[model samples]
Target chain A: MTKYSPPLAERIARGIGHLMFLLGGTWGVFIALPVSVAIAADPIQLAIWGVFMGSGVVAAFAAWRGLYLIEYATIPAMAAGTLIYVAAITNVVATGENPGSGLALFLMIALFSYLTARWFSLNQLLDGPLKLLFKRRQGLDE
Target chain B: MSIGTVITLIAAVLGSSTLAAIITAFVNSKRNKSQSETEARAQYTVEFNAIVAQQNIQIERLEKRVNQLEKAEDYIDVLIAGITNGTIPPIPPRI
Candidate 1:
């Protein structure tokens, strides 16, 4: 039998996944950490950010190790991150401050979450309950 | 609704649509990859079967030739033995 090579699109998708891991890890370490420290974020905010960053780190490690189920952890982490962004923006608005930066951060988080989620879903990183849920949703749609 | 609320709403809409597009592309690519892989496997199988059949035919022809050679050798041995024992009349010596 001849050796099988993955299609170009498949390779590109995997490359994107690797890029996401590198960027997410780097952002968590450099950008998020320094910014949080500079702003003197409170314990709760720091903890939330920690969870978000930690999730990316964990998901990246899981992806590297081929632990698909653990990779799903990023979905909830992104959800929490999105919620925090909303809260931060609302607080800024309440304090009569410009929320442009907060809004931008929120959008960025949302976009990242979307890309990550789609990557995992398409790559078959989900199984068990998540797989069943997707099948059921498709069944309902049909 | 406040401006913040309006912007958030818009962002949510944009995020969801972008997500949908990404999902569609991913699913399509994955499906295409699987279909191509299956096709490749099927083609490989067909080719493999054809080669095996050709080899089998060649082997069968070789076996038949071997059997004919063996029978000819045995008949020649028997004729030599008959002449040596003089059990069958041998050809007369040329005058």
Candidate 2:
């Protein structure tokens, strides 16, 4: 009868998903920020980091602005964007250089990840899969 | 990187993101609007059929009544012909 009434198992699954996401996002920032700050030293590196991380920032901004469709775009953007940044970070660490702007850039990464995950969770709430499951369960119960 | 390069890169990234967001949003909104419109149209059709069915029932009932009235009128005409031909004695009226 209600539009949304997910069962306990589904709720638990969602909760676990969220917990992992939180741990990943939080720890990633904590770890990467120091790493970024340590590695980033040159203006060229800063600009590169900024350009890459800016994609996620834009996604986070869109999510923050409540642009639903555009927000999902963060997924691919983050994928490609994060890959470049991580590679750059690895290069810096390999060269024994500290990326001073790592924190600034990775901060955007954290925000983008957090927002996109929230967006996905919200989408799951409106998903028809749960509704179908509920119907099947109801039929069995009856 | 030069300040110009930084600004250009920033502009490129931001510009692309803004464009992507706008296009995605526009396409999705249009799709949602179309889906809802289709649902509305289907709902309207169902309602229209229901109203037409109701009207049809009324019309059928009216047609039956008309058919009965025609039969009754024919019987009355036969009775009047009998009276005019004097084949049956007219019942005396009680004044």
Candidate 3:
């Protein structure tokens, strides 16, 4: 009807999902840039901070372009990014003699990884049906 | 806590969050594309089915017409034979 009207609920769901993505992306850069600037005193620490925050920029752009297939493709990439953050936090906590701070880093990474896995699983669910349809279309074409 | 340590810890938190955001974006895009494609496919199936059903109906109608024509031909042949054999005169000068 009316050339396929989207349901209001679907529209809202998608909007909220996209907003979460944007907020995550924005926070990534928002926190990274300032943190990098503050850590500029130590060259190695500064470098780590810069790289860590730079990733946030990458993530921001990725979301901006809606490049999600790449997200699905790069499990190792996400792991590596998480590892970098973890390593940086551990380094800081160990240096500052605050083992509790390290736990914070661990918890954050754990949560982030869990959420990412869930998101990827959801994407797979959506993709599975489409893949069948695409194969059918290809068969028709041939 | 040293300033350097503080900076590093904050950066790490930011970095991890950023990774999550990026990963979420990618997954969202893939799912969105998949959904749109599936809807397109279902639509195509409905249209194709309708076309096939309509075609079948038309074919059935044509077949019935052909059957009627064959019966008509047989009747005509019988009428011609009757006239030739004078089995019945042509309506006997319709009074």
Which residue pairs show collisions in model 1?
none
lDDT of 1 by residue, B1-95 (tens): 54334434534554454355345434444433323333434555676899999999999999999998997777777778888898965643422
lDDT of 3 by residue, B1-95 (tens): 65556556655665565565455545445545333423534655677899999999999999999998997777777778888998954543211
lDDT of 2 by residue, B1-95 (tens): 53334344544564465456445545445534322322434545676899999999999999999998997777777778888898965543322
What is the fnat score of candidate 3? 0.07
DockQ of 3: 0.04
Local accuracy of candidate 2 as per-residue lDDT tens digits, A1-142: 1122234454444445334433444444444544443343355444444444445545554444444344445444454344434444544544556555456456656745764565454343222334556777999999
lDDT of 1 by residue, A25-76 (tens): 3565467644322233455445544555445555555444443333443444
Q: Taking the true A–B contacts (Cα pairs closer than 8 Å), what share appears in each candidate?
A: 0.00, 0.06, 0.07
Pairs with steric clashes in candidate 2:
A36-A102, A38-A98, A38-A99, A39-A98, A39-A99, A40-A98, A40-A99, A40-A100, A44-B1
Q: What is the lDDT of residue B17 in candidate 2?
A: 56
Tell me the lDDT of model 1 at B94. Answer: 29
Give the clashing residue pairs of candidate 3, or none: A68-B26
Interface RMSD of each: 11.0, 10.2, 9.7
Per-candidate Cα lDDT values, in order, are: 0.51, 0.49, 0.51
- Stronger candidate by TM-score (1 vs 2): 1
